[model samples]
Structures are given as C-alpha cells and as structure tokens.
Target: MTTATRTLQLKAAPLIVEAEKEKKPVKVRITAYTGGIMTVPGWGPVIIDLQGLDLPQRVTLLLDHEGRTEATIGWGIPKTDGKTLVIDGTVTEATDAGKLVIALLKDDVPLQASVGVETNQYRPLKPGDTITVNGQTITVESDTFLIEGGILREVSVVPLGADKQTMVTLAAGVRNMTHQPAPPENSSPGETIEAKYILDLLSVCGDDMSTFRQAIENRLPLETAKALAETRRRPVIPPVLNAEVKDTPASILAAAALKLLGKESLAEKELGAETLSAAASYKPRTALDLCGMACQMSLGYAPRGTNEIIRAAFSTTDLPVALGVAANKIALDAYQQAPATWKSFARIVSAKDFKEHTGIRLTGDFKLEELAAHGEIRHANVGEETITYKVTTYAKMLMLDRQHIINDDIAILDQIPTIFGRAAARKVADLVYTVLLSNPGGFFSAAHSNLITGAESGLSVASLAEAIAALRKQTDADGLPLDLVPRVLLVPPELEATARQVLNSVELYRSGGDQLPAGNPFAGLNIALEVEPRLSNTYFPGNSTAAWYLLCGPADGSFLVAFLNGQQGPTIEPVDPGADKLGTGWRCYIDIGAAAADWRCAVKASGA
Candidate 1:
C-alpha cells in the first residue's frame, strides 16, 4: 500500500503475455494504471508512452530481479498424459440433451455407484480417477451414468498443451469454489485454487512499501518468499468494470478542461459530473475532474482523467489489513488480472500499513508526514517524493517514425466528446467537417482538436464583438441558409438581444424560412438535459431517455437539447462566471415541423 521514499521501481513485474522471448527492460511498455501498480516481469521489444509523450517511442528500464516463487501454484495447465476416462460397457440411449446415457454396474469410486458420460473439450472419459461433486467423491462407475453440473462443471482442468495459467475471465466471476471434504491428493495447489490476477500480485506485494519494493526492486524471478528480502505491500485494489465507453467527441475533452480550471459557477450546489457536463458542453477538463471524484466512474467509460491533470493530493498512503474480495480483469488491455473495481484499495492508502501484510519493506529516506504534504524542493527528500508511474495504454492508430507527431482530428474527436452539449457539438461538427471539407488527407479527431490549431491572427477575443456585428450583415442576406446564423460561441446571455437578432433575423424576406424540409417528425420537439460535473466524456448515470425512432430522413432538421431552468425557471442565462449560477439549464430537442415555416418567426414569436 505504501510507496517507497527512495526509488519507486517496478515490482513483481508480470511478463506481458509474450515478454519472455524479448530480452532487456528496453522492451517494456507503459500501460496506464488499471486502477493499480503492475508487475514488470522483465524486458522485451515494445512501445513506451511516458509523461508528455503522446506518441510511443522505444524506452527501457533494467529490472533488478524477477519475483520470488511461491508454493507450487494451482491450475498449472495439466494434460491428459495421453490417457482418457473410459466407460467399458456399452453406450445407452441418448438423452434429450444428446448426452450418452449409461447404467452403472460396477463403479471405480466406491463412494458413488454410478457416473454420467458426456463429450467434453478433449478426451471422452478417464479411469482410475475419483470424480467428485459437491463434497460427494466418487470414482468412475462401470462405463458412465447420467449426471449434470457435476465434476466436469465443478472442477477446472487443463488442455493437452496449456501451461496451467488460469483463464482470467473464468477466474474473475468465481465464488464459493466447489470444495471437497479433502482435495484430490494429486491436484496441484494452484490448480484447485482460484487464480486472483490483480489481487494475487497485490498479495505478493503485501502492505509494506519497503518489502513490496524489495520484492519488485530486486527483480527476482517468480521464486519463493524465502529467497528474497520481503517487500511488505498492501494492495490498492483496482476498480470493478461497471461502465462502458461509448461515442464521445474530442471537443468534449478540450471543453471540459476549460470549464474546470476556469471554475465556472452553476445553479446546483452539489456540483457533480452529470450536472457540470450538461451545463457547459464546451468545457471538458472539468468533466475529467468529476470522474476521479466518484469511485464509480472508470476508464472503460471515460479514459480521460489522471493523464489530463496532476493528482498528487489524492494518492493513497494507508494500509489494508485484509482483502474484501479478489481482483478481476475486465479490459482486454494490460494483463488479464486487472480488478473490476479498486475504490476500497484507494481508501486505505493514506497511512503506513503495508508492512504487516506483504513481506516487503519501505526503505529509503521518506516519512508519512513529508509525503502527504504539498510539493517541495528539498534535495534529501527528492528521491522519496518522486513517483515512478508505469502505464501501458493501447490505441488503434499509433504514430511512430514520422516527420512530425500525430495530430488530433477534430472530426473524430466530436464523436467522443464525452462531456459536450448541442452548441459545443455544433462547433466541433463545423470545425471537423469544415476541416474535412478543406483537407485532402481527410478528418480525424486527434488531428483536429489536438493537432490542428489556428494562428493567433485567426480572431482575438477583443475583436469578437466586431465579428458578431459583421455576421449580422448576413443575418438577412438574400440567399443565405439563414438570414443570420446563430452566433453562440463566446457570446453570453447578456448578448441575448444579439442572439435573438441573429436567430429571429433582421429581415423578413429570407430565402430559407424553415428549420429543415417540412414535417421533420422531430419538428417542435423538446429534449431533457443530463447534466454532470467533474467527469470527462461520461453520460448521465442510468438516466437515459426512451429510444424513439425518427421519421425524418438524413436532411431532416432536428432539435437535440434546449436549456431550461425548470417548470418555473428560465431556460437560458447570460454568462456570469462571477455568480454561482445565473439560472438553471434545461433542454428541448425538436424536429423541423414545416419546411416552409419561417424558423425566425417561430423563435421570435415564442415566449422564450
């Protein structure tokens, strides 16, 4: 649980699936904290993503020693030994499930008189072995007897060539393991035992930073605890997988950062992730902050926090005396033993407690008081204060050996703006699509939001008013899409009159006087806003609106979200960063009612 005051090196490094063949720490890759520290087994060829390093390059770290081995672990992928479980007599009639039915005459296991026969992964049946079920140990009876959910289902076996590592998925969901009065005399310790991937590493690391440190720092291969100096480490458990990552835009990422650091005021006092997201779609950094505040949010759903901000105040220092549950791997990335949830793991990290649990010890010069306080510049404590964070993240397209670094394509980014709203979406859409419309290389979210940027000359904040005034000239243009396009960016509620002028239009005889073709199904429609605070690219928790099929085609104009305070509250408000909130934000998503219905007239005439 405790980190080292000296060097925070890789501990009990687990060999990435194919790590053995590759030599040296140079091959080590940095995957993100799957909620906790990981074992760096040794060396291999790999891609490394470090702090400030978006594109992965080659980097290496020399491992002190591999982990010490424990007792003969269980589930050591055992094989059939070229033998099979045999039923001598004859096959009986097939059961409804198509299983062969057999009547037991003489049984190998004296405990039970009969046995069931079925075709499993490999061999048919074996002999001379005891088949146990729910504490009932029995040998193979003459041939086979009908049985279901018995030994085959209860006991896990290895295939002919498997090396005894338990399947991560199978190990994650197991509980109250099928026990016997006495386990088979021949089964290996780990074979009958459930493999707790994430926790298993923690258990080996234990609660003490020094001991855990030595265990990992030593880089001892999977040896016994007796061989190496103890690294007492209490594990900071990983979070359980409960949320899924869906489509989010890149603007959402940028916008969140702006809102959080800007510290915008809002109506709600609670100020959680949901409300913040709905209130300001343009600010994403704030949403990322919200995600870390709640234990429930996870990378599978929104993988934007930690990397986006500095989180020194929240690191764990406490120790854990006992484990509540085992760790499971839900993500396909990283090792197969990641935990589904590690909130409990974090709560215990504030104090020095790992020594008693894990055999590792916390060596070096640091103390608890010094580590928990603010950042400092003391030469003596520098080594202890620094953290060696290891991450192993994977993305579809990685840029390497290129003229310049990869750029974020704003278009693809829009699809994943986990914390954006209608206005932000429109802006991002325009930016992304516009870039696509202009660039020959095409559009990508990474290139747009992070990569592509406008020069300072593009437009200054002071000149924004002039731009709005100039835009007004086109508000009532003869053949433009709108007499005046909505000038939502940088314009606040104080500019409502200006907004109204643009939306309603300065002129009446405009070419296009409709929302979008007639009967747009969603015409006159309204929507409900799901607000969040501090979480990035996250949706409102379980508050999804009912799904309704749209009647209008692709060109149909539709309304997504319209802000409202409440039943008796105002829908829109002027920007007032000085106040906690100007008014409550609400929404109404609608479809174009009539193609020829003057949109400006309808909006201007409405009470809103």
Candidate 2:
C-alpha cells in the first residue's frame, strides 16, 4: 500500500500519523483529525518504530507508533494559526514490485502454505518453468481450469496463432454443440407461435444515476446505459415495453408464427435463397423454408402441410447489425448490431415428440440401464476402463454433409456402420438424453433449457463442436461464466484437407483488410470454423453444451421468424414410440439445440 505525499507549505493545523507500516497510504488532510496520529505496526517487508526524529520547534503535533520519524509536517510554521488549505498530489506509477499475491482462499479453514516453489522443486530440471503449484486456478478465455499439485480439468487447450494458443471451452447445459436438443416420449414441441406483442416504443424507465450509469458503461445493459446514450431530454431509453426499440427474442419468434399462416415471408428476398441481412436476427432464410428440408433429410418426416414450430436463427451481433430500416437511416444505423453471418435456421416441433422429434432427455445421472443400452463398449471394456465417447469438446469436426445441414445418409457415416445401428440408437438416445440433461463435468443443466429429445433426428458431437468453435469466443474464464457471450468458435477436423484452405483463410478472421478495427461496434466475424472431432459429445471442451444469445434491432427494423437446420448426422438407432420404429430420429433440425441460441441474424428469405 502506497500513498501520495504533498510538500506541507501551510502555516496552520499540524498533520501527523503514527509511525507504523499498517498506517500507510494516508491522506494528508487538515480536517477534524488534523492533530491526530495514526499508528501502524508494519506491512510487507518494512517495519517502522517511530523513536527519535526531528520535530517543529513551534506548537507542533507529534505522530509515531514507536517514536521514530515516519513523516514530518509544519516544520517552520508560525505557532497555532487556525487556517485551512486543501493540498492534493500527483498520481503514482504501477509496478509488480508492490503487488500482493492472490490465492483461492478457503472458507472452511486456512491451510499451512509455504512458497509454492519448494513443493514442485523435485520436477525434471527446467528454468522459469512452473516447477510446483498447489490449489491453483487459471482462466485463459471462455474456459476455467483448476490445478491441484499440477493436474488440469474443466479446462483444455487448442492452438490459435502459430506462437500462441486460444483457451477455449464450451459453456454449460449444452449436451452437444450446434445448439440443438431433443424432446422425449410424452411432451411435444410448442406450437409455431407469433410475437403477440411488438416492442416499438421508447420511454425512460428511471433516473437513478447509479443504476443508469452502470447500464451505459461499456458492455453493460443497452437500455439503461445512461452515459452511453445522449444526455439530452432523457438519458435512458425504455425497452420494448417502454421506450425499448430493440426487438425481443420472444417477439421475433412470434413473428415467425405468422409466416406459417400464409402471409408474406418475414424475410423478404433481396436476391433469392441467400438469407437476407434485413431478416429477423440477421439470418438469411425463413424457418418454414428450411424446416421441411431438415425433416425430409434428417428425420424422414415430411410436413403434412406446414410444420408449426418455433423457428429460430443463431448468429452474432456485430455493431449496426443491419436493423434494416435503421441501417437504411444512417443515424440509427449506428445502433444496429451487426451479428456474425453464420446464421442457422430451424424449427422446434412440439407435436412430433414421439416420431420425427425423438431423443432421450436423461433427467438424472447415468444409470446401469443407460450402459446396457450401448451393449458392449467396443470389446466390452465398460467398468474396467473408461469407455469415453465424444464427451463434449466443441472441437470442430469436418462435415460430410455439404449444404450446411446434418444428414445421416452421408458416406462417412456408413464407414462407422456400428454407430448407426439399433443398440447404437438406444445408446444415442440415452446419450442425447444425457447430453440434453447431463453436463459431463460442467454447470449446465438440460432441464433449465427445456430440451426435447426425439427419434428421427440428432446431433453429432463432431458437427456441433465445429459450429460452436466457429461462432463464439470464450471471453469469460470464470467458473460461472458471468461475462460469457454466446459468440461462436469452431475448428476443422484433420481430414478436411480439401476444404482446409477456405475454412482457414476465408471463414476465419484474418488480416486481408477484413480485420476489424479495435472496438468495432459489431462483434467480429465468427462462423464456419475448421472441423475436427467427428462427434458432438466427444469434441466440445469440458463437454460444455450451453450457449446464450441477445437479439436486438433498430427502432424501424422488423423481422419474420422461420425454421432451419444445420445437422442431420447419421442415425445410431430409433426409439420413437409414436413411429413404428424402436426409436425415431431427430427432425425439425435442432429445434431444441443448445440451451442458448448464441447467435443472431436478420430474416433472409420468406415465402407464402
């Protein structure tokens, strides 16, 4: 602890503090405690015992712990002149020299800890290497890791730059990546709904400077950021309910419902099938246009007429995310959030719970029956050894399905023929149930997200990881993920030799002048990552499967909701009670994908 000092050139009250290390960093004020002395014993390496020291010859005051001259004031002032003057000082410098070490403080009881250096001293000789450590926690990016005596868990590593690495991991409640989930035997998907309410007005919520100030601060709540907004008539803009001009997820989802009813498409075509920037959530396509394709390819379920389910699109909100009308108007355009462009569309089907939408939603821990569902782990190495499947890495795996949709009928799926059979289906369902419900070793809970498991369709850890890595950044390293944003991140598999160039060079953010300037309004580009692991559960780090999204729009921009799917990976089994098969496949693409959407998009194309 260090304090600034002022050259006492006043001829009034005497300022004194007891000579002690604890009484450091004092403020020189001639207030009520003018003649009072503050004493502190010692701090860090320094100890003070104010014994004999020079003092002013006039009626000066004294302050010392051990009577040694810790500091002096009023050296040559006239005797007792009751005058008041304010003295301040210049700022101080920063250095590691005065820094205090931090640690995981234990609440139960304090432990006997010495310098950690001596404990790890017995390691293979190396200089500057972390020789020894105990009870240590480190955060790199969006992941948190703990080390005890030198072991890592909950945190993994991946290469980023040639010389550096990106500390990435999945968030909670996401059984697999691609942000999809399945429904179970009884329940069904909610009806294709419309935004019964629209957020079109703006009003002042309140004027609490503290709360308002907190909101306007960087990366805080947009509605209440008082300082961030113009301090004119009102500092705060109410949400859709009040003056909230931004679009709400609920409202957008509702708009998609209307599209199913034979109205004009929510997403109007700028050119054609390309998802338009003016679309809701910044997606290029509508849910209805894509859900049918997803059902046909992934679950083998054809929509009777129009499948009614909650349509969703996932993307990132870069600054000025074409709030169509707002972007049209240069002034408001600045407020539009430009979401990353990898928007995937899908519909959550509630009616097809038992048939096309079939998945096991494991509500509890892994039980014996769950294991039996898998039959034998390869050579029946179950309890004896760890029969680890893709346990959730979010590691990008190359996609065999070309058009950005999961397909079970891919040629690569046929190779692992074992992974596409009946027992495997049960295992897959159980895994989906577990993936939907379990965390492997994370804080996500499937129940919190209301996941629906099903038969006709499912997600492969490989695909999910690839998509996740491509879209998000592990910004927060805290265990609870407070600062975590539902951005995207992805990686390609080692085998994607053909597509590696495009996946790496174009999809990734590079310095081709596409590099975003520091503090760009929109979140930087995050999409179509390099594929790596081939399964969803096995690839995402910490087996994290949870994500989040915040949908925003300009005052004038509006959107229609639609459904789409990015996965239809090969089938492992079918357990559809509604269908004649033992288990149905996942349909509706990923109506129930990750707990959080993690992306945004403007509605792209729409049709009646």
lDDT of each: 0.20, 0.21
List residue ranges in candidate 1 displaced over 4 A: 1-77, 82-465, 468-488, 493-498, 505-608
Report the CA-based lDDT of candidate 2 relative to the real structure: 0.21
lDDT of 1 by residue, 381-479 (tens): 322111111111111111111111012222222222112223232332232222222322321122221111223212222233333333333321222
Please identify model 2 stretches exceeding 4 Å from their true place: 1-493, 498-593, 596-608
Total colliding residue pairs, candidate 1: 161
Model 2: lowest-lDDT 10 consecutive positions: 113-122
Error of 1 at 152 (Å): 12
Task: Evaluate model 1: give its lDDT.
Answer: 0.20
lDDT of 2 by residue, 140-218 (tens): 2211111111100011011110111111111110011111111222332342322321111112324334333333221
